[model samples]
Target: MVVGATRQSRFLFYVWQILLTAALQGPIKPDPGSQLGGDPWPEWSRSAESLASSEIEQECRQSVDSFLRRAESSLQSPLGSRHPNPRDMLFFLHVPRTAGRTFFACFLKQATPPSKRCAKSYDILRLNVSVEGCGLLSSHDDYSVTAVLPPTATVITQIRDPVDRVLSAYEFAVEVASRHLQVPLGVRTPRPPGKPRVDTRNVWPWSLLVPWMEADMRMRAAKLRSTRDGALKENNTSRREFVRLRGHAGGWAYYHSLASGASKEELSQGDVLLPNLDPYNNPLAMPLREFIEHPIVASTIHNGAALQVLGLTNYSHHRDAAKLRGCVAEVPSVREAMVRVAVQRLQGMYHVGVTDRLQESITSAAGSLGINLTGPAWRGKADAAFEYGDESVAEAEAPTRSDGPYSQLIHLQNQTDAILKELSRKQKELEQLRQSSYNSGSANAVSACFSLRALPASA
Candidate 1:
């Protein structure tokens, strides 16, 4: 009944009807008592006539409420109390820029035995690897992964503040772009000592986007230097900063000549990707604020967490064109519906973690998977801290004025922040439930459960 109270909720309710119809078409094991024998076509007309719209809505609402209650109870159950199927796999749906690397290294690998871990993959949509006998599968893929996984697979993931995630992703792209350009041209401009370079040219999305990023940075810097004032401004910055920057020195001249003939390379990268329904422009070339507000970037990642959760972020991989908008819907009503759907899906997950609360998140996930979280596995943050030089570019490119671009990004942040809030709430409830079970002497008590404080820093 409550589901039909608002226009947006009503729309969601209607969408559920379509979804239920789609689900019914699938091969579901039928209950012996619920099976209908003869031709049911004639009965359908009578049933539709007899069932009022209000009654249909009420039934739908009851079914949804029942599901929600079941999911909540599952979360509140004592850790390791629920008997999962022997074949039930735990899948980590890794969201980009959510400290997933750290989670995989510090908690996931340490807790689960190597024998049970599935090889990590990003393009799960394209690959057809057998996941049989693997207790854990983690990837940078989205919710569509459930298609290949068993029905009983327990999905787990971490959520982060969208603003931070986007900023981190942008910085990461810049770093990768810098490496790709520098590595091949290392002879012309040697990289600094001890600063490692990775070859991400073979990686997806990055393989597609990083080259464009390099081209964008090169062209922008060349254009800037071409102007008298821009050349004067460039000389004012420190030599070290200028050298380390993406589009300085030989890069400008290189891109300038290439730009005349570089349209082909640029055009290749612009082929319509799911989120970027349109061709990508020189997005990385824009200022930070402009970059955030760019149509391609905003549509793809404005509410990335929810979009990823719904499997709408990678639309090209999936065939459900009607279901996959491939980005955060621009319509306020549709976006609201999307957020609610994402939250509902997240609430039903076996373990939902928050990037901000790393320790508690790890504890809950470890508890759910019945991992002992001790011995050589109990390590403090495996992620490497940023070097001093990495901060140099941040200082130089700091924004002095902001007016409109930030408003849109801030709004986008609010949307993903809602998803983060729901995950945080779930984490708290699980912790409380575990603490209660421990107090009641119903669950086995381990000494200093998940003692992360004592572990030495990763070498």
Candidate 2:
């Protein structure tokens, strides 16, 4: 009996040795290039590129369980029995020029715990972003990004006054253009007695200049559209020529045409900023009056109704909120029902904050979305860190921007005074349109070519 027991023990030992050998030969070593900047205790990677779906789900479960433990621990004080809704995921739709970067920093600080990770990037939406991994995700995108989210995901967004927003966008583009050149054109002002401050850098498109003299721009755009419509579907020499001609509508031409005079071949690399034209100023420049009637102006007024960019003919122009007016009214070619549906979808968003009222907006969002953040920091005034135009030392030093210079010339304060004056006039014009007593019952306001006839109060 003793001999038999010894033989059995020997067999078990042999089996254990084989198992140990196999494990040593092929041990579990983490990928050398693994994205691993999350909770050290948690077995999750930010990218999750090397993990299987099952592994991802496991990691998610672990993370969620840990989250729940932390949440439940907060409630154990015997103060209240009411359970807070621990929302699975939250999304921030980062619109351009909306103080989004400043707000984003606050959001990240408020979101992830001291140890937990927060995943941020436009690319995060490319993956199947789930609530299981982490609670936060943000991007510079529209409603289309919803496809990748789980049902528990809540959306947050901020909207800016379209006129100010556009101006901000334009100036940012100019800065990018200056940076793109070998020797940047931006003027650096001397810092005051205080230490130089660092500011959040934003990702913005460098050369999306909306044309001046709306009439000329529209005429060119229309002519180009007509030519394209009549052309063949296949690529040919005519197509190539047409494409080259289209390049003339880019930023370099816009800047040079206004600055001095640009030729067809004078486009800068990335076609961002062009070489300054000779004479530095032109007598035959297009006036603000001519630009007031541009199609983009009309498109801006009517674009508010579109919830989905796919519905609008020009995705860029139609991004503005037309206060829920229908695109069909402006672009009669589109279907009324479709436009209505788009409007309805936008109206259905969880939260949309006006940029001017950011503090109230975000606080309200936290309550409605069940995020537990509550502090004076989250509820800042207009001059708080969440506000735009407060980050730069130059901006602090520069006096109230007047339409004194055309585009803001950092050097010569009153340089390009012609366009600066035009911009001032344009601001008032856009404001008038924004506050217009237009026909609200009709859905067409989203993208319609609206006239400036002031409707009587009775109407």
Candidate 3:
């Protein structure tokens, strides 16, 4: 069996290589969207040999935000801008599938019987959102909502392994498509006793319904995916570029699943929640490269160096401690600027967590935010494992795996590798920082150490 599997893998790899080569032979088409083009060419590649330190610093600061800083610095200075106000509204920009719904369930204690949480779509709010009341607004957005948040409100979010995030999103797409079409997919485990459950809303996803969607939508989407796939073969793009360009290969599976609704026997054996509605669905929600985009914040600050986009702006790599380090081989400066922005913004956050280290991330963030999140609700059935979409959708999902090779089990290798690599890097960084802080007699040394012993056996 092992030999057979290896042979099959090798065969697939060769077949993919051949397909890619053949696709690359096509003549180039004059496509518009020069700036946002799928081309892998960087803006700086043409003229500059290498960016100077001063130039990089100036450009980084000017382009996005200042350098990264630890959260402890803000905790020490009471007069510093990051101090939390008791009455402050906490704006949780709940990026789908980042263990955000889980965070809301475990840590939050609404002043009222039910939390006065309101969720919104980015399209409705555009780049800015502000409400009169002191409440929580979780939205699918990047760094833009920072402008509208109350000065006292703290921003909190979680990130997943890039590969995991993408894979999970893929599963979620399958789940959602399955649900809409009344197809039985995964199995659902009963919620554990004492777990908190929050209602999640899925706003207008018109494409979910074929009747409402365009008649030729699937055809157009297929052509786009083919064109992009072919283009990718010739372009030799980066992972990020490939993600951006893969315009929805699995969309056809989604439509097939929809067509197969509620009939397991009719279901395509090879479908993977693949959709033919690629161009119509929101790109950000796709398990693609830009899934970690800085929330579209409302703050006047150009760099997004605020508490809202903390995950993006507070880290020198534009990734919070939770974000998986990308293979940023191309356009290093662009990534650097993003990291600066993340770091700068993170300084403003009360808590930031990652899906891989969800237990620690949740606990650590809760401590900073001054929330006590201990109970069966936290350790309960609700925290089954990391997955995506809104809490309600998660609730509705039955956690059964799709049958066969294309199941999530196969995808875990990439996600696991990414997670393991990040965990190792974080461990080294933490150890070094600990030693440096120990010698320097810094208070941050105490706070920086993440306590992982609190996690469950599976975690």
Candidate 4:
């Protein structure tokens, strides 16, 4: 995809060169033998990456803008009598906190037969794109991974309202943490050991995240209940109280309560038992506000939709990668550029769906891909479907207060909200087109090109 070539800014031209020479040619796909588990959490760092020089950053931004424009323009061409083919590939870009799991189970699995669906890549980046005849791949992987796919591959994704997504992510994180931190389901054998060992094998991708959230919530809770003299109130704290806080209160208590009767040696290894604990300060409880403002959480939930689409998110493929709290969107120019590019990509993708419009999206996507849905589609509620170890958590609910503490950070959602509006508009236009075709008794399949007008570069 190439943007206009006439009287282009020097910054835009430099970006175009990079995109044409590198992105267009695509990166070489590595051998499938190097597959490994996906790294959701890297080492934590207090400092963020320093911004590149103004000129350099500007050039990169312009390059992204130019490429997106070209991509949108390329998709504006009319559709043909093409039908679903066995050889065609489908990539479900499963954005987090969206009803992606539900979509996969209800729509994707139903549309693409088992023979053609690839093994789920939600926890691994190494895909067997070479020999596997699978037609579908879904994961929480960022846009950078798309470079591995062939140009003809169909890329589809579902997005949610930014505020709702952030809230859902928090609720899910707390829910997962409570399960992992709670008592083991089966009877436990007494350890014959010098040190208590934590299980680090076959762990979930959210393992690191669980500990981090626990520590943060504990810290927040402690602070809230602290004395005026800056001391935590720990008077007669019993094991039952600890259990209640850890289990029912969503894991918002200190790691080892005095009443639990943990030994000195066991207490010494508390860091191992619960990673990311601040040894200097006792932990506190967290409500939704603190969760939103926590540096790690802020980096993730703040403008996450745009960042994930632009492939600038901190979820690296390598465990050793330097972690960054990506606050680059704080810069006005960068934010605009990112949103513009993301909106363009969303408009141009093989299929774009919104969480609120699940049934309609499924119907539209099924029509575009020339596949029939197995049954009536339905929207999956986050609270109802969120599960732990095959058992449903009994009382999970996302925060509902619109005037909550997270309202202050609502500005961060501006870009994503804009993208949502654009997507809604596209969906509406597509529906109208479909209805007009039906009224005329045309047998043509409504094309996947939802938006014919590309957003201007200046937009």
Output the better candidate (3/4) by lDDT: 4
Q: Clashes in each model (backbone N, CA, C under 3 Å)?
A: 0, 16, 45, 10
Model 4: which ten-residue window has the lowest total lDDT?
A: 393-402
Task: Please write out the lDDT profile of model 4 over residues 1-100, one tens digit for every residue.
Answer: 2223231222222222221122112122222112222222222221223445564355345444554564455446411123447765677877877898
Model 3 over residues 87-157: C-alpha lDDT tens digits?
44566665555676566654553321132343333213221223223345454444433423444556766
RMSD of each: 23.5, 32.2, 22.7, 23.0
Q: What residue pairs clash in candidate 4, if any at all?
A: 218-283, 218-284, 219-283, 219-284, 220-284, 220-285, 221-284, 221-285, 222-284, 222-285
Q: Kindly give the stretch of ten consecutive residues in candidate 1 with the minimal lDDT sum.
A: 392-401
Q: What are the Cα lDDT values of the candidates?
A: 0.46, 0.37, 0.37, 0.48
- Candidate 2 lDDT tens digits, 1-459: 022443333332322222122211212222211221111111122345466656555545543344335324432431112222343455666676677765666754354442222343432122223223444556554454443344445666677776656544533432332222211113343434443333222211211122122112233333433454455344332322211111212223112221122335554544444222111111112222332343333433223223322222222212221211222332232345444444444455566667788787767766765566754333322111122222321211111111223112322332333356457779989878766645452546543535324555566
Q: What are the per-residue Cα lDDT tens digits for candidate 1 across 1-459?
A: 121233333222222222112211222222211211111222433554566665544434543444335434444642223344444566777777787767866677666556556544542222212333465667655665454454456788899998777765565555554443333222334446665332243233333334445445544443433442354465632211110111222232111111121212122232321121011133224345655675435434566777667655532223331222421232344455556767877877778888888888988877777777775663333122111122111101111111134323433554554456567779999999989987866433433544554567782
**What is the Cα-based lDDT of residue 263 in candidate 1?**
18
> Candidate 4 versus the native: TM-score?
0.51
RMSD of 1: 23.5
Candidate 4, superposed: residue stretches over 4 Å from native? 1-84, 184-208, 217-285, 316-327, 374-459
Model 3 global lDDT (CA atoms, 0 to 1): 0.37
Off by over 4 Å in 2: 1-87, 114-118, 123-131, 182-330, 333-339, 372-459
> How many angstroms is residue 282 displaced in model 3 relative to the true structure, after the best TM-score fit?
23
